[model samples]
Target chain A: MKFIHTSDWHIGRQLHNQSLLEDQRHVLTQIVELAKSNEVDAVVIAGDIYDRSVPPANAVALLDEVVNQLVNELGIKVIMIAGNHDGHERLGFASRQMQQSGLYIIGPLTSHIEPIVLQGKQGGAAFYPLPYAEPATVRHLYDCAASTHEEAMIALLEAVTAHDSQGLPKVVIGHCFLDGGSESESERPLSIGGADKISPSLFKDFDYTALGHLHGPQYKGQEHTRYSGSILKYSFSEQKQKKSVTLVEFDADNKPQISLLPLTAMRDVRIVDGALDELLAAAENDANRDDYLMVRLSDKHAILDAMGKLRSVYPNVLHLERTGLMASNEQLGIRADHIKKGELEMFADFFSQVSGEPLTQAQQQMMVDTIDALHKSEDNQ
Target chain B: MKFIHTSDWHIGRQLHNQSLLEDQRHVLTQIVELAKSNEVDAVVIAGDIYDRSVPPANAVALLDEVVNQLVNELGIKVIMIAGNHDGHERLGFASRQMQQSGLYIIGPLTSHIEPIVLQGKQGGAAFYPLPYAEPATVRHLYDCAASTHEEAMIALLEAVTAHDSQGLPKVVIGHCFLDGGSESESERPLSIGGADKISPSLFKDFDYTALGHLHGPQYKGQEHTRYSGSILKYSFSEQKQKKSVTLVEFDADNKPQISLLPLTAMRDVRIVDGALDELLAAAENDANRDDYLMVRLSDKHAILDAMGKLRSVYPNVLHLERTGLMASNEQLGIRADHIKKGELEMFADFFSQVSGEPLTQAQQQMMVDTIDALHKSEDNQ
Candidate 1:
């Protein structure tokens, strides 16, 4: 059976909730489009549906619309598991009814899991859904019969496969970090007592495993076990790689064939190194010029017009850093007299230092006095 | 139709987790036993089965056993709604299946909802399950046509009661804080946006309103609305009242007769105020001595041996506060040295204020010196 394997749809996430919703909505729309065009039989989302246990109304609406498109419009079967970041019970709600609507939810850790079987042109496939598990959950699930998550999962799998009347091709979807998988900046840690690491060997039995919790897509020695990766570029560290989804096909015997489908965003991210105008010129004709850009510039003279100049072209610019490497070669002209002011008092001085700009000595003093006065009453407290 | 209407079953709750589960289990067992003996047709939990959105495994097991007993042993039906404390999706999991097994979950919310009708020996009854709603949820549920929670809830009820087809006695089960209900010590704050209270007029269409929040079985205004209160007494303030389950009998026209079923617990909390020895003497025949007890003693001199003296008889005296209200005779014998040392440094001075132990004069001086040194260091820094 052909299915799209994806996970870690952390809906309602905010980069500190700093108006990134416009960007988030854009990428999420693109993912829905991909699912529609791909005509995938099923879409398996492996957990982390919401960044928090209590999702905001907008986040809930977003999922409702997206799932509606997948199930009602695209006629694609959707199976979701609860991730470590999710409130399992919250995510697991209406799972029984959603199953009738072709949306299956697996949030609770179950010892006797019912494997959802998806039929394909080639034959049939069994979808085993495993939500992320903590030691306490494992202990309770297995009746204290299994001490750790690995033992409990392994035992559950053994019991499930034992009940498989005809050993059809089986695919397991999970939200766990494998021991050998690559991690990206956005992955949350699964703590054991206090440590956030779990062994990867727990998922060895399934024909193919689509894992989540790790933002970077990676393989765990066995080709079938892989990370599906996150949908969007969430951080500066993730700015380099082109994020993608995994598509898999099971042959007649249920043996699988896997491939990656790269996603090109409306705006890619690029970090550039050059002087202000030079960087702006280079950014103009580049393939990823319209992307969210961060630049580090070296300037000797005050570039009072730097941000004004750069933002005209790259409105999504996140940062601009000025280097002192060129100061020895050229007579750098900026207010060195502003340095004596304390750290919080020197906003204009610091901005000048980092932007190769000059703040008037009066402006610098004003910045200092304004900041100091703000703290004057605070000190009394 | 006769059923026990109990709400706010904040399972996994704790009086700091000290004797929390024991009280909860005891109260729940009593509630079920009352239901069994009363030959109730069903048990209706308005909301809040778990304290937090994510309930512990123990809470889940406890719920499972009680629900199983209500259905299998007593042949009673159970209907529930997702309370504000509940994660809607989690409460919704297996809801359909559970409904098929004589359990009705009224969590799936929509704007124009029909009242859930239940048929019993009384002929017929109508139920409207309204989960707690924030302004945003309320707006969304009403399709943005209504912005305020009150307006949205009113719209929802108008739609629900529109199908008052049989004119049967309609009961509304909701998890909301009505404006005038008695607030319990353990109830969580429902809103952070300045105000969170919702008016009780939203239930004018229903004959009996079974409500979940505000853990005291009381009414809002003169309305038929009633709060079943929380299962366990989660705070010391609720010690005097008997935690109970409410039984409602609906006649052919669905007009209701309600009775309060007392839920006796293994331990009853009692407060005794006097000198430690006197209070202990008064508690000698504690009919419920195995009960948890709090002892408040008032004395001018420090009773360094208080807990030691009281623990022998009232073993579960979890609290011993020295309120320091002295009688005239006790204050008559104060030595000059005792006055100089103040109450804390006298030989009879109470145990260390924090640890409840007798403090040596030398130890007291050292503590003062250390605090002084630390303050000096901080000031220097």
Candidate 2:
């Protein structure tokens, strides 16, 4: 059985307020072409189908068009799950009915999961998909006392294990932060700290595990478990990373072979660093001038309308900074980190700083609950 | 053949910033029960399934559940369309596949429409559903010269008339403001003025025209052509209106019979007029204290924390107005009207007030284009 493994499409993501829909559409078309050329029996998208709970209309249209081509035109099975960024209910719309058309979408954690089995000429594999779910939601659904992400995942995996009595080879699809997985600027943290990270050993009994959330494609400790990563460079920090999908094939003996299939972006995201004048000269001959760029000027003096000047040649320049002047200032880095931290984390840090005591686990849980309630109320409005 | 005709669900609508999901869910349940009890051959939901382009998660879940029950459980055919409030592409997701399950959803104004034919034991009707489309979109889609809603509707209805060569009775389902229809505060204006309203005579060829966008259930000089109104009282102005769905029965002679099937809201929206003291006294024995209320205080003097006090007794009181003090003031009415006008309308009014001349059609079109482009840019973010 051969399958294309990918995740974190983030269909409606934007970089520095610039829409990435065109970039996304370009990469997705390539993915569909790859699936057709490889003749993969199924495409497994682990999670994060969209950047936000409510995706824009054009994003929805793009997804519908791509999925229609893959499932209806190419006749390939699609297995997808909802990530933390997705509103599970909205993503799972008409999911049950769609299953008959070879598009399987799983959303919201429940007690019982019926494994989706894909059959190929060689053999078949049963897939157990676990979409991202909060520990509080896990407790409510399963009636389990899981106060942490690890505990919640364990409970979910236990259910999967019980349902693994089928004779076919088993593959687990999940969206989570593994214990040692690398973090990226674009990935939203599941929790305030390491409590959300789970050990990769939970999938030990499964033949393979396809993971998502991290933006770089890599494996944890084992080769059978891997993250195919995002389809595009979502942030400047991911500029150097090569985006790809994983092609997995199960042998007649149920052994797995994996390989990375590189994807070409419509316009690459790149960083250009030099003096303002030198960068402007370089842009004159740059073949990929339309690529999204982060220009770091090395000149010490302030350049008037630096961004406007750069954009004249490189129309897609998304960010500009004076690296030479700010490289020695550690405060800038601290402020960026502060901006990334959630309100709860910042409050926790303030409490520890002012009172010389960290909040207790119970106190942190209370705060999480209160903050979640507040957000829900605001969302209602 | 009998069918339940309804429209303007506004599933995620709010009343003065208060979430109406519970009320919507309750009313939708009643609608489903009504269909079941009537044993209608089909349920034709004209348009406006959602209140906004992007609905919240809970609203999506509710719509999913309701549609699932109607199509899968009850085995009834449900045909829906997108309204001005809906992002057509988003609303049309999985629509093609859903048609196999007897759920038909039409979105954007396309060049061609395949009429949905619902068959019953007694016979059937061919439904031509036209989802709301902006004049620009219509012009782009059909490559026509239509620059107004009336012209666009005429072009679309021409296509419907062309497809009506079939022997089945033609039923037109549309979402548009008809000429001479009473307006309501809740209905979002499709355009600046009467340019969005079309003549009712345009649907003269169809046996029955089930319309939407108006919040009052009424016929426009003809019983066969009618507005089903909204499912609930979306605004205080609709407090006196009785919301209902139109049930249309077609006989063997191709004639139509229309009846109104009323819906009951979980929490009624009401306005209470009296002094604060008297209102509180009356609330002691009020059976429906939790109903959404607008308190009009008649006290001549000031009442501190009036809203806070009324909320204690009438827990769902959403608004408190000092009608006693403002009774003699026409400025307040003028201010209310000013607030209701759109930016373009306000600008036009201001321009007219200062220059004593109305904006030329070309200039008005330019302002509309600029404003739309600005809004589109913001929405992309």
Could you say which candidate leads in lDDT?
A: 2
Candidate 1 residue lDDT tens string, B1-381: 787899888887766335366677777888888888888888889988877665655576567667767776677788888877775654554354445456777554756554667776556677777877665667776766655555666766776667755777778887776776676556765543224566887776578889888887887854467888777676666776677888899766657888888777667766677776666777667666666767767766776678878878877777766666545435524532343342224423555545677666677666655654553343222
Supply candidate 1's per-residue lDDT for B167: 70
**Model 2, B1-381: lDDT tens per residue?**
799999999998999999999999999999999999999989988899998777777888899899989988898889999987877888888676667778888977677877888887688889999999888888988888998899998888888888854689999989998899997778877876557878888887689998989989988857788899999998888899999999999887899988899999889999899999999999999999999998888999988999999999899999888988785768768776876677699889998999999999998898887877765554333
Cα displacement (angstroms), candidate 1, residue B338, comes to 34
lDDT of each: 0.68, 0.86
List the lowest-lDDT window of 10 residues for candidate 2 chain A.
Answer: A372-381
TM-score for all models, in order of appearance: 0.68, 0.89
List of clashing residue pairs for candidate 2: none
- In terms of docking quality, model 1 is incorrect
| Candidate 1: C-alpha lDDT | 0.68
Error of 2 at A335 (Å): 8.3
Candidate 1 Cα deviation (angstroms), residue A324:
7.1
Best by TM-score: 2
